[model samples]
Target: MTEHKPGGDLTLGGQRVHERLTREEPDLVARVLARIQAEVADYRRLPVEELAGDIARITQQTVRAFARCLREDRDLNAAELRQIGASAVRRAEEGFPLEAVLAAYHVGTREIFAVGSADAGSADVADLLEVADRTLAFVGTVTGAVTRGYLEELRTKIGQEHTARRTLLSVLADGGPVDAVARSAGIALPARYLVLSVELGPHADEATPGIDADIAIRRKLRRFLAAFEHSCGDGVLASLDGPGGLVLLPLAGRLSAVPEWGSLLGTAGRAAGVDVLAAADTAAPSEVREVAGRTGEVLDVLRWFGRPPGLYRLDDVLVEYQLTRPGEARDRLAAVLAPLDAHPELVETLSTYLELDTNRRRTAARLHVHPNTVDYRLRRVRDLTDIDPLHPAGLPRIIAALAARRASLPR
Candidate 1:
């Protein structure tokens, strides 16, 4: 067993080329920067004096590293690869286009080839070809490292921003130092926010046997985020956990265009292929803590009554909201429907009747029953509860009782 020295096999011309490249590395690096500034608009827009110095330093380092690799006929060592990666990350942080970065490397390589092979005799053809092959390999390796480093930095940056936004939302909703958190998160606190508690219903694919439920849920979540981002831009903040979570949308004073939330929710639901239900209310920054809880309760009441997919504000569900609160009255009201527990059909008919504005025919149509059957069920409900659902006094009481029962029951 012996040491493998691939570079020992380099032809005379190849060795000369490697030395020239190493000695002229500074000039080669400058040429690379000049080419990039000429060809790439993004690079040209950077502050010329300061950025050019920085680019020249890194480009010289890169050129020397490749020269060493060429001389040894070996690949970049771990430390060299790390240096390349660090430089790439810096460029990404400075908002440099990856295409321009790669173009700079190509320019450097082309310059090296032009000088290295300029006076190559016919006998040096093999070495020149070998160098060309190695240069191509070098490009592949360096570009791969550059891309990986650039994307990783970008992803970390995005994740940090997301975490900061989430933290800001928490402070706003849970009573904390709002100004400090907003400053740290780089968010401007608005005078008011339309706080929302959202509940996303399962998509049809979630229940299908062969489809992956998690994938369906993620797809819906992405659509929801994209829709909200498109409509509200960066002003809308949210924390989504599984089926639902809190959202805060910044208000832009009287002159700001407030989105028609109903239409937006509809578009979100359609895009996500899921049912969207949200409870919303507006509040000043200082009042967000209170409105946040109120919005959550509003959503709870809406869900307890099995409301259809849509947006609901406190005003829309005031009666149900009041009746669902805990008390002896609520318990007694809930008990009014207890007798009909064994007679589910009667309870269903009465609930539907009340829901449809006491319209008998609409209840019959909704329940898929004849009008005669609807009448019979109403009579049975009256006998069982000792309350006629049609009477003005009885209507409100029964509606409250049903709401209380639904609230107390498991969802």
Candidate 2:
């Protein structure tokens, strides 16, 4: 074990000061504790029992160790340094901030020096200087140990929390014992959750040949997560990657409106500098697995139809969503558009005409053709399908047929 020696060898005067500090050790410990609590707000907020028990004991041991180092004319050995670091780990586990932990040590050291040097006269200059130098050395070593230990523990703790959250989300998305998983994760299962299945469009940087696409994706993900945290409080559980992921927002009992969460997609997209699409639904805790499945299906439906980026619920694309379902009805509707498929131009014209709300001029403008050409195409469609494009009754069928056709095509 390496022993840290605080510079010069201890002289007779340094020994005299150490003796005085040893005699006042008990009182000095008390003074250190009181001063730490008084000066550091974190310590002051600790419960009385903890303040008197663990904190007091640790403070006393630290003071004794410091005095012993001075008396032995050497600094803490590796084992003693490890002990100080272990105490810092304990403080981290107890949710003590690293700054507060360091503050406690600083306050303790100041009090120790003040008390040990209280009785020194002008003739005791060498003794006081030795004490000051030793105090600085001890503080430097102790603070470094505390910082390293606290940060290491904090990193481990954060990793554990992230793993737990992912586990909880997976169990909620798939079939599992949600209650037990939630317990293990130390998260309360809300009565209801707003489930979102997200898809992210590629950022421009992803296409730049010189740029690392993975790095761009990762940056977008970080921006997205930050946006989510800012818009929605930290209780949101999400599992996301570079492209996209799933999110589950815990809804407060009758207080949280689901629509509020739907707005997050736009904010997230803008922050990430990418287009975003999400399919959202609300479900109770028990129904999360089923609801998640449906939400993903809805998102798939949106992508199949080439819908614009935004938040979509089942209702947003109800007709298209239902038409894509496998059934005799969907097959029949898809067949309705098959006749016009032989003439690709007619099919294109009909689709553009309907999309333009039957405005022949707008359809003509979009197709870059004369209005007469659009009329001729519609007539050709009517001739082949025997479905009048102008009739209100036929309009519904044509629209449904178009949706069915688009849904059936290769995605």
Candidate 3:
């Protein structure tokens, strides 16, 4: 900003102003007309909306700063002011009406230039005019080159950070030093072993118009995480992204009153519209990394099956029976009823017969068939499957198979 002295003798106080504008303002532009013109040519290539926004924001900030400097009677250098103007030019959004920015430079310059004396200022007048006029011409080229460089640098860094975060989470699952990373990320760990999972949720496939997905997703994560403060005890929260985010909370360690807490918290998650599966690790913070590995199991279930969102213990949902080891236990039992397999109707008959306890009257009543038919299927099963319907081993295998099949059945 140029300041006028109270005395009649004018002095060029060029030390207080920003540099970019000094380069672009007329007193400065005249010296760099060729460069400035080339820059303006490049500005024309940018979209009008982008340019306009840039111009509005940049001018607003610069004008405000210039006004302050002038009011303060600051003695800024003329060269610095021109550089400030040029810097503002760089920030102008596409189609930012370079003319308006150039005009603003003049508006700001006139305010400060008045402080100087005709004798002293006239000496630098030619140089100032040259810098200002040329700023309009070369601003576009300088700004574009600078912007491209910045964008490349920003994108590279963002990619590196995202990949690093993912890798850290994976290693954390395998007993890596997660506490240090957690602290750096601003996560606090303490009592309260709880579960958290990230989900793409219902809108995964839906495209929202006029919304930048990255921005929207981040906003959503912030909102969701805030809700947990009241819902769980203290601990570090790291994102295990997918559908639901996994949060490892330290247990309060007084496990006396609420043994059924897993189900309790799970129910709350369901009500909140977040499907979360948690496995409780011990209360110790040192045990957290090991617990993180078990998170994969929760993730698997989250992916493979639709478990009702309710507090659930990992132990409670145990796989009590196996479908794969059919020959080892279940099949040995099944072999007793080999004849039953050969008799196509034996399965139905056995089910009905068991219900009726093989009583002819009850079997007939339940099957809606004659007693003779019931007896016939039973005999055929005994012949083919190699065991009588009344065999003790046969009953246990049948019960076990029913239980196994029930669980494997898709709901």
Q: Pick the candidate with the highest lDDT.
A: 2
Clashing pairs in 1: none
Give the 10-residue window scoring lowest on summed lDDT in candidate 1.
250-259
By TM-score, highest first, what's the ranking? 1, 2, 3
**Candidate 2 accuracy as TM-score:** 0.74
CA shift at 283, candidate 1, in angstroms? 2.1
Q: Give per-model CA RMSD.
A: 3.9, 5.6, 15.4
Residues 1-411, candidate 3, lDDT per residue (tens digit)? 655332112123343233333433444333232233345565446566654565444444443444344434443345534545455435443224545445444443443333222223556564455333333333343344334544444556556655555554554545566677656655554543544333435333124787776665555445455545445543334573434556654455433235545544444444444444554434345555655555445444433333444444445444422331334664454344444444546667776676555576798788788988888877776666555666666654554443333333345
lDDT digits (tens) for residues 1-411 of candidate 2:
645444334333344656666778888888888888889998878889988988888788788788788777787888888888888999999998899999999989999888777766776776567678889999999999999999899999999988898888888888789999889788888788888899999999999999999999999988987887675566678888876878887776432765666566688889999999899988887888898889988988887565778899898888778877878998888898798777899888887888678999999999999999988888888888889896778997887777778767875
lDDT of 1 by residue, 1-411 (tens): 645435435454545666887777767777777777787677778787755677777778778887788677789888888888888899889878888887877776677677666677789766767777877888888888888888889899889988898888888889889889988788888888878899988888889999998988888888887887777778788888659788787765431443477777788778888888999888988789999999998998987676888988899998889889988888888998899999989888987898788999999999998999999988888889988887787887777788889877876
Q: State the local distance difference test value for candidate 3.
A: 0.47
- Greater-lDDT candidate between 1 and 3: 1
Off by over 4 Å in 1: 1-15, 97-125, 253-259, 344-379, 387-397
Q: Model 1 Cα displacement at 235 (Å)?
A: 4.2
Candidate 1: RMSD to truth:
3.9
Error of 1 at 397 (Å): 4.1
- Candidate that beats the other on TM-score, 1 or 2, i.e. the better one: 1
